[model samples]
Target: MKQRYHVLLCLLGVIGCLLFFPRDLSSALTFTPQALYDLTASRTGQAAAKPVPFVSSGFAGFLDENGRPQYVEKIRYGAAVSSMGIINYDSVSTKLVMRNRDGEIQVAIETRGYPFFLKERLLIISTDRLRLKEYTTDGDLLWSATFPSPVTACAAAGNRFLIGLLNGNFLYLNEAGEPLYSFTPPEGRIKVAYGAAMDAASEASLVVAGIDPQTAYLLEERNGELNSIESFPLGSDLRRNLLVSSLHGGRFAIEQEQGLLVVDRTNLRRRYFSIPGRLLSVQGHPESNLLSALSQDDSDRFVSMIGSESNYRGRLRLAGYGPGTSILWSGNRFIILVDGHVLVYRLELI
Candidate 1:
């Protein structure tokens, strides 16, 4: 009788430890806002003076005074430049490139793709194919590749890369473009390629999150195999018009009818923040630990900078953030960060 009673007590102790210890322990692993903010701020500061203007002329894809496309010239440096729907910026060489449906490349000098330090390489994808390119600081292509199928979207985690396809397929690759593993979705109508990122909390893990037709999927990859899949329903309103803007590193950002959704790969948890009006554009700042949203207001536009739980709204201006949500800087003319210095410009739009 005494031994039975002691065994019961030990079982109860194990249960208590499981319930309480992991919760508190996980909380301690999270980032502290002060520490992140200080690390970011130390690397960013206001520029001594306004940026020197890099001017151009022409509109509607026409050339400017210096014989450059108006759009390209305007965003030559720190712009959120997108082409063929893929967005990326390089700070070392100070260039931004976008791919268009026609397979044309747009290069700009000043740009809105700020917090410029995050993107070290370029990612390009399409419905029937995929490509990875290395670049020099002067807009020179270092190397490029064409993958197997029509790639819908892509994300990079450290030295690993994740690519999602229109046929509900995905491939994991090393930095050198060697195949590690592949996965297929359970459903066929999963035409849209939502988002993907590396799972930092787990070793050799990748998270592919997206809306497949009317359902949302969180697919987990470990040891070159997809072992678990979690599904969530976003209801009619959000499900009907789901759009995913960006996924890189271990972060995923999605835009649905309800608002913007951000998820961390490590925790398998998510957070939603409402937009004041309809969203025009959304992008993730990997290094700065912030997400940017642009909305149309009358003739002008407004940009909102949102951190994990806090919100700050500003007018249609240029801006950038440092890694891990550490620093935020903006300006009226142009916002460009070169070697940790913020450069704002006054333009003479010709």
Candidate 2:
């Protein structure tokens, strides 16, 4: 009788724990935030007042107004300009080349017409009404693919890119610029692709988030096909600016005006956390729903730790510092570009 009573008590305890903590308790790991050096503050020169395009690798970078990699590891700027700086453009097309301090042609893309974006080392050259082209950091032509109809939106990352078309359909392409998957919404449900993200290997799932008439659509790419399309109702005009970003291995983040919506690969599990003010950007944590976001206040931006049990944990250590910043990478250490500075910080959240 005593042994049976003990077993019953242990079973009751387990039930109580699960009822209180329903989520995956194992996800609540300790995450700490650490600060590193600043780019402009550590360098000697001032950047051109104009906003210049910048991109960073692990330690080096090509800041605005210059086509050379500054050895951020050594804290030295303009110290090692590379000889590959001179780009020989094709006579038939108008092209621009980005040369790093290492003299390597980090990017050589022709964006004479339509929209052009230089991300990391890949050059995204697009013709809004037609096709898109991509180039490698070494000026190598990766691939060029065209669409069936007019494209309304487009985004790229890691190993793939996506384009939203006029017919309420979206096309996804690999790093080689080959079209891999296409998804079309139900007839008359048109949403432009405003943001997109995929796992590092592009093997888990691709998230394409967008808006049309205040309705947001979410598409999931899986197993060489697209399925599990979800449409979210909008609360305000913020739905017009729904932005999507990769969260983790099989999750993604969507930034609406009120807060953020995070979804797993299956498209069944999801969560939304309301934010206080206008969010400028959000960097998702590598392991949890917890994230770091930049919120705007009177034209100045501050960092906020979000999605904690408190909903709003607190301000980040480097809050309200960089304007027009971008989170370069997310993992144990997060690198971001604020103004002309590339800052690195250690991140930990529980």
Candidate 3:
């Protein structure tokens, strides 16, 4: 009788404890509603500072971190979206105006060609696209370079910039627009560099160049010199500029066909993830393994949250197809414009 009473008491205690302290059901990756606004509404003005740049509904503007409209204006020619700010061009005056998120004008340059921002530097491409000039953020002309072949692609990180030429050559330039290293991939039948990316990190800065005929070259900058580390053969032809990004876990991602080819930096082992439909853009968390991708599979458009370790998190469906749909991801917030509604979703813990 004593033993039976003791066993019953222990079982009852366990049940009571479980009932009182429940297990945490929080998810590692989830989304919460942050803010939403209708871009169709008449919300126009020069907004406050510290907002993300977006283009929608023939309007270019800045949105706060909370996804609220800061500054909205009717675009004339076109607008270039950058992490720092935006470059709005005036076709009539042939002037390019650069503005920061704080609604402050950084520089205004009058050029016949279109001007785009590469980090803090402004690049003005000639009307024929054969000549390129680099300028400071204050609109001072630094240096000009004319290429015999067409410039296929370009990327900038911090003080460094990479330019890929159609002749299969790639050039790495320093902060003063001086060439640091230049190389051409030998094995490619078509000597063309499709894309290039540089690391913004001060330590162990890496340079990635994607060449035509499906090859990616990796270079590391150390002790003021660049050394070729490794090369990977991508099976598909990169028709457009390569979307290569160095991730958190010593890995990098290259957009190929209907998926992303994620390669390990150490062993050069490759893992492919099918992102469904055509991959538009990829945004990754700097400290974590999370990557967000925007894709338009046929007429259905959505944003997929993916793990760098080949794990599928979830996806959020956006408005249907057309020029009206656009999405941008920054920090933990996702700003999406579907049709005319602008919806913002923040990464949640629950």
> TM-score of each candidate?
0.47, 0.62, 0.81
User: By lDDT, who's the top model here?
Assistant: 3
lDDT of 1 by residue, 82-194 (tens): 22222334444434455332224645433222322213454432223555554444455444556655565566556666677655566767667777777665542444444
Q: Which tens-of-lDDT digit does each residue in 218-292 have in candidate 3?
A: 777778777778876777785566677656566667777888877666676778888877777777775577777
Give the alpha-carbon lDDT of every model: 0.42, 0.51, 0.68
Worst 10 residues of 2 by lDDT: 74-83
Please state the error at residue 97 of candidate 3 in Å. Answer: 3.1
Model 1 earns a TM-score of: 0.47
Q: Return the candidate ranking by lDDT, descending.
A: 3, 2, 1
- Where is model 2 more than 4 Å wrong at Cα? 1-38, 41-93, 101-121, 127-129, 148-152, 155-160, 174-176, 187-191, 201-224, 236-241, 287-289, 307-310, 316-323, 327-350
User: Of the candidates numbered 2 and 3, which has the greater TM-score value?
Assistant: 3
For model 2, how big is the CA root-mean-square deviation?
15.0
CA displacement after TM-score superposition, residue 210 of candidate 3 (Å): 7.6
Error of 3 at 291 (Å): 0.7
